[model samples]
Target: MARAHFAYFHPFEIRFSEVDMHGHVFNGRYLDFFDTAVTGFLVARGCDEILSVDGAGNGVDMADAAAPVYFVRRAGVEFLAPVRFRQRVEVAVGIARMGRSSLSFALEVHGEGEDAPRACGEIVWVAVDRATGRSAALPASLRDKLAPALLPQDAAPASGGA
Candidate 1:
């Protein structure tokens, strides 16, 4: 994917705890990096606070809610290169598709000054009813705020084939 396509990036350092005995970052850790990037992106856009659903499925304040939080429904990743310790990786993420109840994310993990990424992939997340754990429509306000960071038309093929 082209670097210019992504509008959000979160830089992270490779901690010693993240590396395997072979000195390369563990495969599972890439998911952590992407998760962090996604959270950062949403927070930066002020969308995180919208997740205040209560156990009864009503929208409420986080301080008074015990909602079932957002959950990843599916994720896919392709490791392009091995990332080792002592390196800073910049994870760039963009919204590929936003649906009534789901969102698809495209992400690229790049090392400093590198043209190619250490890894690239997509994650699918579904908003769920807190009490039932079933899919729920995403709030219009949240989607509107995230519209500016959606991937360009050519970057990912959106499903609403209209």
Candidate 2:
């Protein structure tokens, strides 16, 4: 759990379902947006899609691979701005560290180029043994693919990001 940060970027759109009674995206929806961007970033880096394969094409053939499921063990998020209906946003996701049983990420969210982040968060990932659903090492090949995208800096550890 030493610090080793690596950064990445991806884009998304705000949807009506993501909003709350206040007309702004609900606090929880940000996490979904964060996941969308992170998934996209990892796919671009050639990692097997952990969640789905429909949009990532058959190159990695996620469905045919020995997929390892990851569970969020911890997260730390800071909301800096509000996102309203129909706004498009982009998030930058970075790995701040990698450990034997887990990995850490830094996420920066923005309204697609407004010069300021709408939010920033840290995410922690741990591979789980599919059958037992307990902690395990991230698969070596997948780790190799994801390693190149780790942020070039470091930060204090955050336990998880869901």
Candidate 3:
């Protein structure tokens, strides 16, 4: 897919702590990068309320019957190249798909100055009834806010091993 398809990009500076003995970023840290970018995308698109905490600040207010909470149903990462410590990178985020109760976010991590991504991945989140924990339709408000970032179904990148 063309990088232009991404409507939001969150940049990050690789820290020494995130690098492994292999002299590159630890493979596991990509998930953190994706998670952070997801939040930024939502906020940038005016859906910050989706991640709002409860009044008590205990958590996502799973008790609120009117609010649906999202949970990570699946996550995958395909590493294409090694990212060294101190390298600057950016995560491009876009909505790959939106289902009745789930959202799939497509992401690409590109090192600064590189023409291609160092990694690509997808994270699937399921919306569930706060009280019942069962899948629930995504709120219309959220769907509306996120519509702008949704990619054409066929435009999403193919998922697989690196």
By lDDT, the best candidate is 3
lDDT for model 2 comes to 0.70
Residues 63-148, model 3: lDDT tens digits? 45577888999999998889999999999999988999999999999887665788999999999897788999999988999989
> Model 1, 1-162: lDDT tens per residue?
677788888998899999999999999999899898987787777775554544444566763243334678888778778999989989998888898888888888889867677788888888777777788787777789889988886653222121
After superposing all C-alphas onto the true structure, candidate 1 shows an RMSD in angstroms of: 5.8
TM-score of each: 0.82, 0.74, 0.89
> Which candidate do you rate higher for lDDT, 2 or 3?
3
**Candidate 1 runs further than 4 Å off:** 51-60, 63-69, 156-162
Count clashes in each candidate, considering only residues at least 3 apart in sequence or on different chains: 0, 11, 0
Error of 2 at 96 (Å): 1.7
**In candidate 1, residue 136 scores what lDDT?**
79
Q: After superposition, how far is residue 29 of candidate 2 from its true place, in Å?
A: 0.5
